[model samples]
Target: MPVPATGRLQWTDVPTPLRARLEDALDAPVTDTNTPAGGFGHQLAAALTLRGGRRVFVKAAPDADPLTAANVHEAAVLQALPPGAPAPSLLGVHRASRWTAVVIAHLDGPHPDLSPASTDAEQTWALLDKLTSSPAPAPYRAAVSATPSTAASLHGWAELAADPPADLPAAARDRLQQLAELETAWPALACGDRIVHGDLRADNMVRDHHHGVTFVDWAHATTGPACIDAASLAPQLVLAGHTPEDVADLLRDHPATATSPETTTAFLTALTGHWHRNARKPAPPGAPGLRAYQHRAAAAGLALLSHRLS
Candidate 1:
């Protein structure tokens, strides 16, 4: 039921006119193309050698229609970012027909393993802190407030307790039920209007020799509780084999991340529960890796909850 992690779209997939616009934006003929080394999206970073041997990264998405506005918003957000922020520079935005392409200065660096040594944890926290602290633009804040939370996300643990995947362990199923019951006790926490990179997994970050870290994939950017972003990071941390001590260390050093442990456990439990439910469905995108990561997070959440209940 799980799908393989499909890589990014190819340059050949671009329409003829869109390609021309891209070439015009760069003022260079695309000498060669290199597949971007990450997740499924309509994004590509090609190594383009211009007529004069200048190189830049060219990225193309679609124009402002209902389907493509997210890309436009991403470009706008990147453009508005404070100078000296580690993010890439937005070179230009061009529109042709239904397609829109945003060009950024090519970053040369190594992709650091998401799970770096403890020495690198400070840098990681700093990057997350900067991102979480940035003010959300008015339009982005409005859009996130308007978009409703996914039904599955809102009631994930309840749904899982009613009918869990056959593959999930009995202990995991029991934890789901407990989490569902616990959800009733907490008030619906208001997120207020904080800016968050809705998805900030390890694969989305690239570390430059000079610039430190630059996060890519702004498509999932949204305005929400800072905790949700912290919650999102937990799964990745667990998958990387971080211990409870590691998590505690992160929270200890970064007080803003120190949400109530019970609340964080419940939130992460629901997230993993949702992933498990989706993984069992037929032809689910990212089901394989999603299921794997869900199990890891579920295990970590159960451990935390056990400590809280004791």
Candidate 2:
């Protein structure tokens, strides 16, 4: 299935003052703007062609928006990445008139399709191998900790089991108590020394022809088990039309996901529960498509978990 597009702010929708500041930061006049599709969608994300034909990607948010802090964090993460990391280079960060924007050198490519047998999957997995083997940079390790963050964000099965929702599937509801217990295992299982792109779905990656796969959106980056990022690829593979059994087998065979069987099942359960709970909430402002996307992802995740547990 195609990733949903979270409706975003257009270039024309930006205030004139902020636009001028952005252009000044680029040191050029913007000649064209193209908004990319399929992200969390609470900011201004565009591919810009400048006066000298330089192309760059930019994401801007109001100073008051949560995305503003995310962009700031992402800028810091990008700056700290080692030269060989498969991510974009941060060009500059600009802020003015209650808005913040980060500029990045653009990589040309489409988001990878992770269906079984696709070359995109091969390239993406190769990229993950490189990413997971490298230790987090010193500066990044000092700033962000993955354990507490994962513990805080990856809770849902326990909460859901406490008060099961009306829409909860029979597969999960039947095994709710078991799942609630299992979901608690990821924080320990995810503990490691490698850099983890906490969110590693297709939409968060671009398959550059020359670069293999280039990761984007670093707000969730942290140091943890390489398998944390590697395991994230399973549900996305299911979403791309692979069977749950196949995805499970692939994860087992992948070097990065060398954890025990219990660890893999626990992480998948926690991830499914996270999306299952979030998918029921009201859509955030400017991201009407997010809930639907989450709902689909939750279903895909649940399917994989069901197979694993079975």
Candidate 3:
């Protein structure tokens, strides 16, 4: 994943009143804070060291910020995760001085290396298995409909085909109509009730040496086909230096992707279209590197989709 261009806010940058309120809510005094790099947004994500030597992960954003809602949603999803789910436990959600914060158990580890020959890939599969093994909780099923939430974003191929962009990649231009058709197949094929980490990627997972892989970032969690999470990993695997064909073969044999090959093809095509179209737009308000990252990811997705199409 590309390092976010806009640097994250330091803990000290958080308003004093808000920080005080956060500490009060946690019932602990903050002694120190550490902010890590490499995320997609410009949110305040830090690990706080409490007075009693306890550590917790906190992510906060202004009420007006888009991420504020996401933080709130994440807190709810984490709270609703069933027992034994490979995810962090939600500690609390604090809102003060027009800022929103979601705190969770601190997970100490680095993002998994998804390159070929790495055990991290297998660990990710294991996590996916455990995650989808059970039905989505009642709260999530009532609050989120996975297919409709993402269908609009994934329909970009149809729009691009109608009025192709000048900077559209050569490979996509040659098969624009075919891709447009394939992109429409996901809605029908993605019907299921399993909870999926809708945005599964290397950066969204942390590999704890002792505990294996732990999934993070539940903001995009949704109820969909068992394969959604596994399909989301294909482009990332390609980005990690595996050939598109190899990623396809690996996913084909995985239990999560037990659906027809067409399902994976359509999902990847729609996903590629989303990135390709979005990458050409202006950068988002707080994420300068987002479009550039999308451009690179779109290339990877296109390569993966092309192989599947052939």
> For residues 1-310, could you state the per-residue lDDT of candidate 1 as single tens digits?
1122454445776677888888877777777776656543434546556677676666664443332565566676667655555578778877776776677677767665556454444576676777667566665565555444432144356677776667666556656657777654333642435666656666666776777777765656665555556666655665666765666456534534575555555555556556556555554343235445545556665554454444
TM-scores of the models, in the order given = 0.79, 0.91, 0.91
Write one digit per residue (lDDT tens) for candidate 3, span 211-253: 6688888888777777778888888888898888888787787
lDDT of 1 at 79: 71
State each model's CA lDDT, in order.
0.59, 0.80, 0.80
Candidate achieving higher TM-score, 1 or 3: 3
Q: Which consecutive 10 residues in model 3 have the weakest lDDT in total?
A: 144-153
Question: RMSD in Å for candidate 3, one decimal?
Answer: 3.1
> Over all chains combined, what TM-score does candidate 2 have?
0.91
The alpha-carbon RMSD values of the candidates against the true structure, listed in the order shown, are 4.2, 3.7, 3.1
RMSD of 2: 3.7
Among these predictions, the greatest lDDT belongs to: 3
Scanning candidate 1 in windows of ten residues, the lowest lDDT window is 1-10
Candidate 2, 248-300: lDDT as tens digits:
88888777776556766777788888999889887766677778888999998
Clashing pairs in 3: none
